[model samples]
Target: MNVEDAPEGVEEPQILPLDAWHRARGGRMVPFAGYLMPVQYEGIMAEHLWTRESAGLFDVSHMGQLVFTHDGDIATVVRALESVLPGDVAGLGDGRMRYSLLLNEEGGILDDLMVTRRGSEIYMVVNGATKYDDIGHLLDALPDDVTMNLQDEQALLAVQGPKAVDALARLVPGVEALVFMTAGAFDWNGHALWISRSGYTGEDGFEVSIPAEAAAAFADALCAEPEVKPIGLGARDSLRLEAGLPLYGHDLDPETTPVMADLGFALSKRRREAADFAGAQRILAEREAGPAVKRVGLLVTGRQPVREGASVVAEDGAVIGRVTSGGFAPTLGAAIAMAYVPAELAAPGSGVRLVQRGKVHEATVAAMPFVPHRYVRASASPQTPSKAGA
Candidate 1:
């Protein structure tokens, strides 16, 4: 989703704990997801390049932090979650996390989230704009024994890039030991923190979940490091796009299915065999027969950037598909985009035509991750491959 624009019908924007801190550092504040957030600090291009070369900090406190617990069987809680989400929650080991999609009864995606198994409690981070809707859906589907706690008092931050580990490990020792998609509990200056070795950028990074009251101090400490600087939502969007990650409410929505969105990897083999999750029948059938349209990457032929709402048209000028995400890729030094097109035209190297405001632009279908991913993983660990956009 575009971070600069707030959704329609939203109430007055709320202030985050770091509102003053951001403004003090010259952050350009804007309305986003019913909150006044910074869209840029130094600048989008400067911050985007800095994160790729060194380390950049991001304030993602707007995301929802949820914890699930049960006094009864933990297996019951797993079963309840599996009924709504397609991921293999039972197979997740302690401190392990998985990228999952919240699906409707028809198999349409309601929201995309990260679910981590932390001992007896299940921790989840959902998109800020749809957290309340997601909570309502889970409450209606979960068993009475399963309890969901929304951690509104927490603030989330992400430090990402080649040197992110070096900068963050200094504040909280032992965080460097965690591998990709793993998490652990730690303490810093008497405050509790739940940190995970994962992030939206396709670089080595860590996301810290800390107490909201101590957020400013923690942010200050992080930025004090020579290698780290505070980044904004603009660079975060470009980074995730270059990483070929989908943005919720933009690249994914209720009308989109996992198969159609090219996110079939989220469906574990064990769950696919059992065929027990929501929308199993339609999803499985689409997996076998193929989706009508597939999400693919596009390499524009010029320096001019393409924005959302552009159309993928046929030779005769009939609208065939639409662009979901598009922008100038700073890392690639060219323009790139993500769009849904006919399955026949989804192959890499296939030619396509794009039209925005009566101007036709030539583009070629290409593989995703316009930029290569640099996540750090242990060779001995049997963890599954890292999921895009997690």
Candidate 2:
């Protein structure tokens, strides 16, 4: 199938480093993020449940791995990035990562990304579909002093689930010590690796960045463990949805801001206090008075699942919002959805209507994460010095 937000013209789907491995494992490939990625293996439901019960390996190599550097100190690089993103990149400690957004001049979201301070340099992971656009935006917006390097030769993997830690710990020792949102450099069979204690799935897991040439071997080694299985995009979407996480181009876009998306947390305390970031005036005002509309979760009354672009209507048949993402929540045993609605109508338990397949389904404003997030929250600590390695 064609991918969402694919370029206008028809183009050949690119192959990932693990493309062959995915097909070898019975993966049903589909076009996504401009690549022929595995959408499912075994089945979506089975893989979804297996990931929640055991470790599920995911091939996220399609994501853009980027490195930002400057001839000056880390502080200079941090300040430059802070102008574009609302996150506290300047105060971010070494080995620590923060979920942040690239905002437009009007405070609208351009893309969501993970920012990690790797020694004097900064590393970033952006969504696959938006990486090219993001790179161009950075080059144009950032100062001439900052340099951007896209790691095209690198590949990414995610080992997510309750058993994820144990499965990965067995491969690279010491990774177990890294708390949530923390990362460190390590060596696996002499191949340098960058592992982060974080994932899109709410479950405790790690995202490992390795050389493209070693990606297949590394993935094979992880799957060798009895607790681990290779999961595909179908399960990955379900898992993230259950975790209440939002997907770019679906739940988020350039038209939405952090406050409107219920992602104000990405605006760090320091940034909020200083109000020094891009679109600060508009974002801060919305924070205090609330946005005209907000993103919220919905629980459909029946077994039928709603889908993206579904109209969210009111009791009087007035369209109030639109479903950004929705589906049968296997874990919840019910249909759930994420949508944007007027702030007053976004309260939990508020009644709404979901129009899917030309049928209006009863729905209620529900709390997100249809499932609970199992992130291993880190304890309070002082900043540590940077370590040198991949």
Candidate 3:
């Protein structure tokens, strides 16, 4: 009797604010995230390469944006949220984004999302399709004192790629200074925009939430740039997969707990020791017992890519698990995928067999992110340099 297992029914398809803009640009519309969003504009492979080599614009208006505010201590407000999420929400610095999960009572993940502390409140952005249900869940779970508000007036746009900073810097001077996972409001083209120096693709980029009415103009203005071309859902999926990120329904769901999904790290040590969060006991027990099966990255040895739902077989021909997300990684120029394999066979450097086209394709359990992430980092390792001073 869970929400995800609710009786089969269909709701009328919805459209984003930029639906018209997408069609006018010759985008191929498809159903995704509960909206008739553009699946590809200039084709998937081309758009994927474009995002890596230059810049790509995406109308992520389908994503949900919300703002929350309450009286008194921020810790109290954050604690209420942290009780349900896996991340150390209480320790997040102002304007810093933290990736966490919304958990069910049994510690199963409902969604993964970003939370940014802004001033005396918190700003949150979640997947487009699950936002409404997520909001209601939060409302029902949170204490009465905690308040939540939907930022219905906003629309989201993401500008991502290697040249994302320079491409966006033209509008908001000094934007390049913002480090990864940091966000704040800035003026762009005479309109106030909330720009976050983070994105899904494995590159330096920004996700801007602007006024709904101005979203079209802002998107158009960015698209006018030489390097920025409109990308669609197909590219977005490929990019995130290449970055080793989990898609909602594919990599996460109510049936899979955070520990089983290998996302227990999102739960902070402080929270873990305190054991105050939702489904903490189950999540903690799973962590100790070691999940039977876990999500792992795969490096398919051949050109034939294993698509989702593809069965993974052990050396002895036993069905060990199944691939949850798979595709050709444009950046790596090879097929990559994520699968849930028995813990015994999930180690990196291990070899497995993937069945595609009813034929066995040799694959290795390579570490995630078949491609390297070029995030804007400072004072860390020899790699991952800052965009501004690099």
TM-score of each: 0.95, 0.94, 0.92
The CA-based lDDT of model 3 is what? Answer: 0.81
Q: How many residue pairs clash in each candidate?
A: 0, 0, 0
Q: Between 2 and 3, whose lDDT is larger? A: 2
Candidate with best lDDT: 1
Q: Order of candidates by TM-score, top first?
A: 1, 2, 3
- TM-score leader: 1
Q: Summing lDDT over every window of 10 consecutive residues in candidate 2, give the lowest-scoring window.
A: 381-390
Residue-level error in angstroms, candidate 3, position 97 = 1.1
Every model's Cα RMSD, please? 4.0, 5.4, 4.1
Task: Please report, in order, the local distance difference test score of every candidate based on alpha carbons.
Answer: 0.90, 0.87, 0.81
* Residue 27's lDDT in candidate 1: 97
**Which tens-of-lDDT digit does each residue in 110-169 have in candidate 3?**
888889998788888888778887877887787777667777677888999988887788
Q: Give the local distance difference test score of model 1.
A: 0.90
Query: What's model 2's lDDT at 292?
Result: 96
Q: In terms of TM-score, which candidate is stronger, 2 or 3?
A: 2
Off by over 4 Å in 1: 1-10, 380-387
